[model samples]
Target: MRMSMTDLEPSRVEPEERVVILDFGSQYGHLIARRVRELGVYSVVLPHHAPLAEILRHRPRGVILSGGPASVYEPGAPQCDPGLWQAGVPVLGICYGMQLMVHQLGGRVDRADHREYGPATLEVEEPGRLLAGLGPRVDVWMSHGDRVDALPPGFTVLARTAGSPYAAVEGGDGRWLGVQFHPEVAHTPRGREILANFLYRVCGCKGGWSMAEFVERAVPALRRQLAGARALCALSGGVDSAVAAALVHRAIGPRLICVFVDTGLLREGEVEEVRSIFTGLGMDLRVVDARDRFLAALDGLADPEAKRKAVGETFIRVFEEEARRLEAQVGAIPFLVQGTTYPDVIESGGGAAATIKSHHNVGGLPADLEFQLVEPLRDLFKDEVREVGRRLGLPPAIVDRQPFPGPGLAIRMIGPVTAERLQRLRACDRIVREEIRRAGLEDRLWQAFAVLTGTPTVGVMGDRRTYGEAVAVRAVTSDDGMTADWARLPYEVLDRIARRLANEVEGVNRVVYDVTSKPPATIEWE
Candidate 1:
């Protein structure tokens, strides 16, 4: 079970004392790590079966076992290192992680008669260290089919739900704790309290880490890695890339050349806006018009994955062309800098986790990319990246910009990408953002944009029966991009958006709002 260097690569900026989160294949594995980081004690995620040596390598103050979808009894199910229990570090097992811990110990776990899969009330029985501050009855999110039926020796029940008797348990030296429900999700209102208790009370973390410290550490690391080599940064004008560019520029200064490519899939006036923003910062910025190239690559591609790959490959090719052109001016650029964040990496199958979707930058890149990727912000979340941007003195407009997909409007279009469809989506997307901003909810919501469903609907426009494309508007609120809830914009604002789309934007008849959350549906329709 020993890991190679690549498999054990540090995903984020290395913190001196961190909580090591073992990913057991849950979609929320990274979410668990994010929650720990939000507590100001840095965390790193590793595979569930990572060896004990590897776990100790992180100098973990605490180890959190993330919930997974697999049954522990199933053959080939992921298993933890048996030595972990005796390793002396505090361990908190969650969901399947709890089941595994119980099963590994002398405890017995069996399938519950009724599976607890949603919001449930946790009644504190003993109110031990884990549930000490929370009141008797606490709300929690549960998604487990199997429950702990019998406790191992020295283990005591802390809390219980109707469906789960041994919902929360503590055992052995006051360090080992287990919870059947997830404490990382938004559903658990005081989940942060529980995690903070674990970090500060149990693990004794100082909670001293900050994004400013990350910038201080990252600049020195970047300078050391790049030495004097010139780098071409992929500037998407979004928060991640902008922060990454600023950090890299701080490290390498004039040697960092930012290349902003106009994919034509972007919203209206984005190219000019990005150009102005970076040029004003005095970074050597290069703007390339690759609209036709991107459109050609995306032509006839309806599958979301296909379109993402096409766009991704074309972006690398364009960057390569730009690098070649600049090679004569600035000799031999060897590094390609991108704003690839932790969510992008996890979603694109970066670690041992499953791939929900292939982000254009992470999964969509060509196999034969020549330049070495310098993702300064790869270990960061969206919020953390913004903090780093502020620490690096980036403009408010760039740092606070909403999350935009690397594939841009191409993925927003449901069908084949065309010049006409791009224009249509751009207009609709702008109006949705404008209305959201006008409602004074720009900074409140995570992202607000319009999706071209590409489904034709018949409606009366100016008393004429006209069949045009249907557009779906999506607005969401989220802490990190890991989980999101549809934003409930005021009715007045939604009405204005709908009316504007119907009258002002060309060839739009129907407007619909997406109410689905992140688990059932992603923020993006595609």
Candidate 2:
């Protein structure tokens, strides 16, 4: 059927050479797993209570014990299978994970009189294989309450900090290792290099997994699912929804209905651009302009969650009506596809971590909506999704499109979802993007957009005092959305962006740049 999502029966991705991470209920566990995968190795995180037999089934070349919130001596503290170490595989434990290992191997761990919660300096005493060439003193990130009182037999202290006598240890002739600090976090300066060293030098792992490999495996699996069925994908013009719909189009061919609901809250020229991009790929794209209806549903709503939920319900109604219209033309379309990623699932409380926010597509869907959901790129990150899109022959315009939230500019409007405010924010957003593109910084940026704070500031325009809405220009640089730093844009670019928004955008008089990082203020203000 000539498809862009392409075809293949996904072959097994090295269960033998994989690094199996044991999760002990730490929020950082998944981050640890992601760090390992970024090292170009196949890695998976299993529940802390996973059976010993299940652990052996992966036939892992190495194992990592993730940090947890619980102390090692708590009554119901999570514990690894004692046989886990007996498996004779190399292991590296972090934080609570390190404490658990010490207790298991006949060492004492107790609550410390002084708990280390942030940064600490480590003095590398022995410079063991793990700490080789790490210099005389290493700055490490520490977040733990328990300290190892004594080392287990046959273990040597590689590094030590002021708060804890033991910070890093090595035993079993370099086969076993533990660290009190978390190397998965960005706060730890040498985290990535250390993980890479473990993967390449210690475990002797060869990375064979790529996003292209994922594409080959997923295409055929999707084809098998939609063999004779007609599926409808919800298109948001963002990377996730676009990639999801395009992949399904490659599988189902003419049997796919790609519905794009234009809620009038999208950026300038977005609706037209989206339709043109999809149709250029020979996709059966359907554009539904239910913007008035969406604004109507969100009328008088001020809270972010309330506005998001309203938008979600309205989107379902629009899609349902669109589905009915499509069903009339083509016999029946039953499957509904979405590009809900792993971070979305985890942030929406579908993973081990608590709910951070409700994504409109994943968590904001109405309970009574009537369609089967199909998400092909559910497990990939944003960068991974872009790679799959490239392999599917999607042009850079779509593949490299900066990620937009599911609720569109409705969430960015920061106030009532009226057409007036939508237009203002859209204009400001357009100027921000145009200036970034003009400076040739668009490709390097993670996201660059204008967020309307819905607050007005006074300005003198041609010697006349005027009050108008203020827009904050947000630009960030990030490998993933998990953590981000504000992009240090050049003064020339910033000056141009600010000057254009004030001069060109009608209702915008004040333009401000957000300098806060992700830890304190999210990239998206709302």
Model 1 TM-score, 2 decimals: 0.94
For residues 183-273, what per-residue lDDT tens digits would candidate 2 score against the true structure? 8988889878777767777788887667776777677878877668998889988999889887888877888888888888888888889
Against the unseen true structure, what C-alpha lDDT does each candidate score?
Answer: 0.88, 0.82
Colliding residue pairs in candidate 1: none
Structural similarity to truth (TM-score) of each candidate:
0.94, 0.85
RMSD of 2: 4.8
What is the C-alpha local distance difference test score of candidate 2? Answer: 0.82
After TM-score superposition, the amount by which residue 468's alpha carbon in candidate 2 deviates from its true location, in angstroms, is 3.1
Per-residue alpha-carbon lDDT of model 1 for 66-150, expressed as tens digits?
Answer: 9998888788888899999999999999998889998898898887898889999999999777887998999999998888999
lDDT of residue 103 for candidate 2: 90
